[model samples]
Target: MTTATPHLLPGTEIAIESLPKVSLHDHLDGGLRPQTIIELADAIGLELPATDAAALGAWFAEKSDSGSLVEYLKTFDVTTAVMQTREGLERVAREFVLDLAADGVVWGEIRWAPEQHLTRGLSLDETVEAVQAGLDAGVEEARGAGHRIRVGQLVSAMRHADRGREIAELALRHRDRGVVGFDIAGAEAGFPAGRMRDAFDLLAASFFPATVHAGEADGLESIRGALLDGRALRLGHGVRLLEDITLTEEGGSTIATLGPVAEWVKDRQIALETSPSSNLQTGAIAAWGDAMVDHPLDLFYQLGFRVTVNTDNRLMSATTLSRELALVAEAFAYDLDDLLALQLNAAQAAFLPVEDREALMDTLIDGFEGAL
Candidate 1:
């Protein structure tokens, strides 16, 4: 069923919710609907902060607004708890896809750590299978509802956990079945991508792609490890990549100098999965400034960096891809062309084959052209 979506853009009749968008860094565990969470939790005798859906949603929003990444992550405990069962996982995943479809996400890569779903005697493989089943159903459901949407799973290994290699293997095992790529998520400060070197080595050997959570809770050294060790083709919440860009104002114009790291990321055109609301909530953009306009996405885009907007955690940030796009457009004063460029950047960086990605690009081009 298509959920009703309010137009995020106010004055323009162009509905941002109907625009073609690709989400590269959405989290499976972080995108559950509040009412679904209530039902799922009730099924397992789990205690929730609030029994009512609205209050529960408010709790998540409030908890996530703490401006500390560590503090913000505590809300996941409740979400992950309910997802321990097959039913819980499937329902959440199904609703997740429906919500994305309603918000006009044409392509999305949903990431989650399968290891966390093992508390109910489910093996890692079982967890992946459960989620894949849900994703399959969701895709069909969305299609049946006359919404053309596609979602891929990015199986993530929790960096704070020691199951990186195992999760990578699990992802490879299901590559043909819905799983699209691999990632290492969770806390990023202490656990750099190098800490999962064995996992990265195997993923590298298997010719699999990865997108590491770097430059969010940490800095340049962490991003360096993601590229050099984790072999990441994309940076999750890489909002901190701005640390490498030095901007100096001379007279009335601004002069920007790219540091070695920024230059490399720019030259390689590696996609930065930037989440505006999430970044601000977690203080990821503090150094740049304390506003959404402080985000470097516009700067990155204008400078020719492959930048893609994302909702790192929809539930945590309480955001949809459309809302994120609207906020970015408002912050940067972007027009429709800028939006098309962002979608094209994401389509190009997708883990699919070159032909498939080009096809996605064509779809976006046609869709955006039609919108005009």
Candidate 2:
């Protein structure tokens, strides 16, 4: 589903692909190459709906754009079906990093649930190891190819499952290896982050950071649970947080009033991992409007919220980080400086140490300056 050429800034000669970027909310299972899926499915004797790579890619994009998160998520069953083995996990992870590097991401955090891959007799720890191995190989390969990329894992627990603490421990166990943070993903409407209080409590005690999938399929209360109960450092697809913001016209100026929840998130500088195409496809921003111009990301950015652009599912959305940025730029009329600000926001919000984040910021500044 990727385009044949790099996406350039709307009225400029700059290719967005040339700027350094940081990706904080990409999904590993949601970014596999179509050809890789076909080969992996073939290895497992799994019959695919479409044998051709391009057709399979289109199929994922078609199914994912159903405007229902649940329906959109059903496409993962096919992607994950092929990701049930060690080789499958490694190859997908490696290619995921390579794709990110190709899209100009210098640092990326890939999130995936290990519990979903145990159907092939692999333990949760083994799954983490396999993915990390692939990520390392991808990083090495990218460096060899002169891309110089780095990646970490954000091991997730399925919200519908009862393995919150188990997955939390798994992430903690591999913290020094490659696991950088923790998350809980799945159906977000009924499954609040509070249900995994014990898991969040454990991570809190250990001082490990978390990014919860709230404000996407759910509303204000879910974001509340993510912060108060889950102690999330960032909100995954917090597009719906705009619900708590009230706008009114006063003397020819639009004034925005922030609710307590919105105030806290804004005051604390909690990053909103906003994915435009995926958000539109999942109806995460339906309350605002269905069009890319209607996304709250620009509003959040203008209001001084820590907003960062992302490609939540590259394969599902048939997009890359550069494409997401280019789309947002076209919709919002953002210039090179605005794009750099967004990248700096993401670099700051990344699950990395202060020195590392500073180094990444420097790299971004240098790269953007070079482009100018």
Candidate 3:
């Protein structure tokens, strides 16, 4: 599905892949190369649903489209199975960055749960070090190949697991190394961020940033817990926050009434990391309809929300950051300026220093100007 090549601006010569971009919600385990997974699983003697790389990739795509978040998560068993060792973690992280670089991502944050990588006796600290080493090497490799990409890790704790505070501490310990932020993911419907109150409290006291996985599998209440309890600066697939918005037409002018939660999110410009294909695959946008055009992303953009495109799981969604932007551009008839504004929105919302974000924005401007 990532074969969605660089799409032009409808009637223009600008190739979207040639522009600078930012990825804020990519997953480490979920972005593995099929061949990499095949080899890794082979070495570990783990039984795969498909022996061949192509079939394995297809299996992931099919399983993820099962339309239940719980079923969608089962595919991770294959990915995380191959990711239990330091070598697996490092190699996957390395290739993850290279793939993003190829897709024109100048800045990215890769989120993963460290607790899931300890089956091979690697400690939390060791797991982070391994991934960081690979990310650092990937950056150098990309730069050597004439691509400049910078990345940071978003350490996530599984919400249903009891290790939230532990993972938060692990993230804090690696902040100076390569960690950028903390997040909680997994089974969002029954497991809210409030379940991790101690973790959020600890992260809050340290003034660390978090982006909660909310509104994808749940509704406004989960989003509320994300902001009030998790203190999230961003929302991971917060597409369902639209449920809090009521829309109508008066005299041919659209009027949107926002619930208190939606009001705060829109008014504060909290970024929504909307992954198009992933949202559709996991049935997150079932209320709106089951197509990219039906996605609330365009509506959110029109209503002034800081909606940023993402590939939540590149392998599962079979997408790249470029492909996601291209899909949305087609769905909404977006122009080059609209795409540039989306990238700028992401740059501003990145978990970077103001000066660094400004530099990224400048780079985007220069590349976009060249395209124009």
Best candidate, lDDT-wise?
2
Q: How good is model 2 by TM-score?
A: 0.99
Please list all clashing residue pairs in model 2, or write none if there are none. none
Candidate models: Cα lDDT each: 0.89, 0.94, 0.92
Estimate, for each residue in 1-372, the C-alpha lDDT of model 3 and write its tens digit: 235457566777777778888999999989999999999999999988898888988889888997788899989998999998989998999999898888889999999999999999999999999999999989999999999799999999999999999999999999999999999999999899989999999999998999999999999999999999999899999999999999999999999999999999999999999999999998999998998999999999999999999999999977788888888988999988899889998998999999999999999999999986
Clash count, candidate 2: 0
Clash list (residue pairs), candidate 3? none
* Model 3 alpha-carbon miss at residue 281, Å: 0.4
Q: Pick the candidate with the highest TM-score.
A: 2
Task: Kindly list the per-residue Cα lDDT of model 1 for residues 36-112, writing each as its tens digit.
Answer: 88888888899999999879988999999987889988999999999998888888888889888888888889899
Off by over 4 Å in 3: 1-5
Q: Which pairs clash in model 1?
A: none
* CA lDDT, candidate 2, residue 330: 96
Q: Which scores higher on TM-score, 1 or 2?
A: 2
Q: Which consecutive 10 residues in model 2 have the weakest lDDT in total?
A: 1-10
| Model 2 lDDT at residue 243 | 87
The list of candidate 2 runs beyond 4 A from truth reads none
Candidates ranked by lDDT, best first? 2, 3, 1
Clash totals in order: 0, 0, 0
